[model samples]
Target: MVDQVTSILKEYSVHTDNKMNEIVESRKRVGHLYDMMKYHLGWMDENFNLSRASGGKQLRSTMCLLSCEAISGDFNKALPAAAGLELIHNFSLIHDDIEDGDEKRRHRDTLWKVWGVPQAINTGDAMDVIANIAILSLEDTVKPKVLVSIMKVFNDMVIRLCEGQYLDMDFQTREEVTVDEYIEMISGKTAALIEASTGIGAMIATEDADIIDRFKTFGFKIGIAFQIQDDILGIWGDPATTGKSAKNDIRNKKKSLPVLYAMQTSAEKEELKNLYRKETLTEDDISRIYDILTAAGSLEYTQSMANRYKDEAMSRLEGLYPGSEPMKKLHEIGKFLVERDY
Candidate 1:
């Protein structure tokens, strides 16, 4: 299953990256703006020279294409939308780096850090515009009504992503953030794009509303689980694997699921709160917080929640296309999301 998922990711990544590159290179003559976009995408170096750095897993785009193939057996029809999904995801990442004040992504200096915030914001905005334009490439392939529908879904996803980002930033400043609130924030910030990825792919493949809804729901659940896994990694992941500091979330005081759960349930909740309140946390402070969270079973609780969502996501595929290879691959991908270390 891992090998199958890897093959699917590699196959679709090449397709999606090629499509994205074509879209961006169409305007390469426009100068450093496009270069900045390419840099963030890992296609170019900070100095505008070409380089092949890791961008990410390209999971959303792969899911988009895979969902389309699972339904219609013709993933080619969804290529533009898949590329658009990836570009928009990167757009969010660019802005997110600025918003979070993150210096590095994928072990390299973040776009904001390299080019400064102002130009990075402009580059992100341009990338977003290009993402919209990328989807417009589908106009010649799909019917006008279908194109309009896809546009609506795509735009709604962008709006939700922004709202999620707003809530995430807002939460950072607040003293208390409930688990429910965190879920709501991530639904918009993280899950909306994933939902749209699968939903739009299904839309491109078929006109069946029921199947589309199921795919969207599957995406939403998988996305939730994906974020939970990320939250888990944020604290416990190996820095060599995750490309971030150990206990990075605690260092940043991110009110992730485990921390919130520990705060609510741990006997050491007050001490945890006090530690978080400190302007700076030492190595000892981070270790103590880890102990408190572990003692409260926060990691176990978070992992269970992630698995629950993943299981639900897998359930959505049952009876849709029984025994289909693509359907099986989707299930594998869902499992991988919760189980991935980075």
Candidate 2:
């Protein structure tokens, strides 16, 4: 599945390159600031030396480009929008890591950890400005009306992303977070940008409201499912491959779907609550939490929900493109995200 996603992304390597090049060029006046952003993007080292590591999955950008290509004949025209979406995603990640007190991302120290919180906050703020600029760059490639529509959608997504993040932070202390509430939080926090990506892609490629609506639905469902999959991985994934500690979320006592499910259904709810209230968790606590999660069928329930969303995303794509390669690739990507191990 990793290779499959890599193959699909290969078709749009230039878009990624152009996006990075633009980011680099956009920061010529502030070399230090650029270095901070570059390091966070996995493009350079702390000393400003270039690195060969690929930045990220670039999943949202790929979906945007794919939606454009599926509707029209090319995705290059939507490069700026794709870049903007990627920037927004990374911006949120920078803030999220700070909020969560995470130390690592992609196997390296997070920006706030390496550069201090104030600088990291400023860098994230700058990235938000640059992301808006990137979207406006679409003015050169798309019609004025289309650019206006895309910007409006992008703005709404940004607001929803903030609301989702707030809900997520609030959930950390709120013991009564239900499954439905978790869904709403993730829909805003994780899925809103993806929804914008595909929607803007289709909007750029065509003017058909129905098609754009379908694409938005596709992105939203898959985005939610992908987060649920990550929650499952957070508890049970192989730390070696996942670049995270086993039961990472358990140690943090995050209100992920699996934990919430266990809280609701496990016979050990009182024990789980008592454990979660501690300031620190030992490996023994994590293991016991895992046992409680498993005994409550949390893992199975989360997987079932992921599958349900992926299935619905695929269903929405049906007849939208018939047998086109882009449509097929979108379906494949949705499946891969939900089913991937690492």
Winning candidate number (lDDT): 1
TM-score between candidate 1 and the true structure? 0.96
lDDT of 1 by residue, 1-342 (tens): 667778879978999999998888888477688988888989999888999998788999999998999999988889999999999999999999998888989879999899899999999999999999999999977999999999999999999999999999898788889999999999999999999999999999999999999999999999999999999999999999777889999987889999999999999999999998999899999999999999999999999999999989888877988888877777788888888876
CA lDDT, candidate 2, residue 246: 82
Q: Candidate 2 lDDT, tens digit per residue, 247-335?
A: 88898888899999888889999899888888899989989988999999999999999999988877788888788988888888888
TM-score, every prediction: 0.96, 0.95
What is the alpha-carbon lDDT for the whole of candidate 1? 0.92
For model 2, how many clashes? Answer: 0
Q: What is each predicted model's overall lDDT from 0 to 1?
A: 0.92, 0.88
Residue 290 of candidate 1: its Cα lDDT? 94
